[model samples]
Target chain A: MIADYGYVGLFLVFGIIFVAGALAVSWFLRPRAPSPEKNSCYECGEVIKGGSWIQFNVRYYLIALIFVVFDVEILFLIPWAVIFRELGFVAFVEMVVFIGVLIAGLVYAWKKGALEWQ
Target chain B: MIIPVLTLIIMLIVGAVVLGFIAVSAMFLIWWERKVSAHIQTRYGPMRVGWHGALQSVADVIKLLLKENITPSGVDRLSWWLAPFFAVVPVVMVFVCIPFGNIFGIELIARDLNIGILYIMALTSICVLGIFMAGWGSNNKYSLLGGMRSAAQIVSYEIPLVLAMVTAVMFAGSLSMQKIVEAQKGLWFVFQPNMAIAFAIFIIAGTAEVNRTPFDIPEAESELVAGFHTEYSGMKFAMFFLGEYTNMFVISALAATLFLGGWSGPFLPPVIWFLIKTYGLVTFMMWIRWTLPRVRVDQLMGFAWKVLTPVSFANLIVAGWILMK
Candidate 1:
């Protein structure tokens, strides 16, 4: 188990150092100019208009929700994919059924305008 | 025994070296990208730094080292500081399963876990979270939007990517990178009809996974203005840049190992052949980045879930049926 997580630990250490080092270096080098204009949300030099936290399109949320379902299905496919040659005919049939259901969901999304570009 | 200890020590040293190599390669690749873009657009690239700007990365490194790292006044200090760490760690971890050569296999591989492919897939997902943290922690709206877009894009394409991987695994009959490579001794998986479809899906998904061109909606320079890491500067920004490039190499290397007969060749050392194939894939990725235009976020997501996911899933079923006979 320890062996399994060795890379995780290494990653943690390096990640901390990189972030900390960056923060530390920026503290001393960059000029400390913090005027309201300097800190304002950048808008390509246009005057700040609406709040930055305005409501985003709901389409993104719909897309993400559908994505999660398909993504999980894909995960299930990985284990099946690795063992498919050995599982053979039984696995092939099982996968087809699985994909058939997912495809139905995809078609539903398509019909409901979940995939339409706004 | 003593051999185990020696092996452990050797693995640690080699792992460190590989991490350093990846960092250096990413920096060089950045400079190369700049020079290539400049030449493409008919402008001189880094002529002031050194002859052909070979030493530009080194200069950039020095400058970043000297640059001041700032913590935003209202930001979450801990997560803000930790974002870069999270960004880079998984990129390094993915290298373990890469079969560089026979003698240089580094077999212990940080963890000789049986489910190497699954492990890598999980680790890569963790990267999206880090990007989210960086964007949110920065307290910058553009950064936040970039992060959200990245999360959606990565999560969406990951389906096709995993499906494509599954097709390969189904044909290879094992999840271990070494086993998969070994299975390809006679003929690489890419040549297999089903695997060819899987490979195409994998490459497209891989491109999106690394947030490269066409799929680079997260960091759309024209719109998001540097995207999720917009607020990051100095070495912190460098870490994100390095992580992104390293992840690119990792995905490419894994693709090579799975489909291109990793470390298997006649003329040169196994490691050299493996690296040659890996870099060849990387160059292909670079070519795509240079040539393509960024896809809109909605179109990107639609293409993945609507198009890629279905095709890849169908490909898997087809592959399974073909293998069964």
Candidate 2:
């Protein structure tokens, strides 16, 4: 079974080599002249602003935190969903309860306006 | 213990063939997109190169090869250098499990792992990391914003995407892509009412995942100047382009296999059927891209959480209850 994943690994190696080979081939063919101005980062021809690695939006973090909760819910659901039939109807009700709890969490978040981007 | 040498050789051959397809298909899709978008815009694009400019992508590739590879100063050298490879490699890894149809004595899949669908989903999300690296490593404001928007968008849309996948897993009762395709043999999942909803959700979320129009807030060219790839040049930029088309193919192939009875039709060979369905979906996506304007970041993220996620969840429960009954 573990050997099955080896094909995936093999493909990854092939993909890496493909990109590297293309880049290497182009390296030989492509021009290499670069001035300081040519090497400068593009910013729509306006001289450089302050550093770009400044503080980001709080909303990105907010969305990420919310994503974590749902992502884990999905992780739990996959196993349950797969085996829910053999586990019987009781398992079905249990999932409803589980999803209900998550939906309630979503409602709570909605009430708090955490979903709002602005 | 020893692994069979024949199996290794066969896989190597298949890998090379897949690599060839990647190169050929990217060229085809570049030409196709140009023709499609041109017709939509009332213009004849690239007609002079070869029959309707079919060889236009070939010419473009030569140009790209001869173009300059400019590495800007002050960039994070390693990340900037490696980002294009990161963008591409994972998309290639997915083809191994995609069941292309049986030929000779074997299923044309490279290897049909038991966890194929899950594996594809997980590998695809890695693409955002590459984009984010391109943005951050470039040390440019627009690239950084593009990367950040992409990270936020993928994270939000992934919920509906995964949940929609769960719906398929529930119905198919397996994670293997081939088995999922086989399960749909008698009844294509899209034919069922609940599954039709799942298919809709899957395509919408998938469009977002690949960063196509209407969901293309991350790479909005008019706003972000080619977004995360602002600083990449020449062949490095070409790798990103190839990855986008290949990733589009991956998602469409999954949609075909999962919902459209993959590689299984009455008359024609299975691989041919598979190609038809997959390309049909790809063409549909390109049509949507040309027709719709890019959505704003607020609308893109909000639609994922509010509309798609909740509807898919409700649909999942309904499907589950019906399955129980």
Best by DockQ: 2
Clashing pairs in 2: none
Docking class of 1: acceptable
- For all predicted structures, in order, the TM-scores are 0.90, 0.97
Interface RMSD of 2: 1.0
Individual DockQ of the candidates?
0.47, 0.82
lDDT of 1 by residue, B154-254 (tens): 88888888777777777778888888888999999999998989899999999999999989888999889988888777778878888887888788888
Instruction: State iRMS for model 1.
Output: 3.0
lDDT of 1 at B248: 82
Residue B192 lDDT in model 1? 90
Please list the residue runs of candidate 1 whose C-alpha ends up more than 4 Å from where it truly belongs after superposition: A11-37, A45-51, B1-8, B42-44, B76-78, B103-111
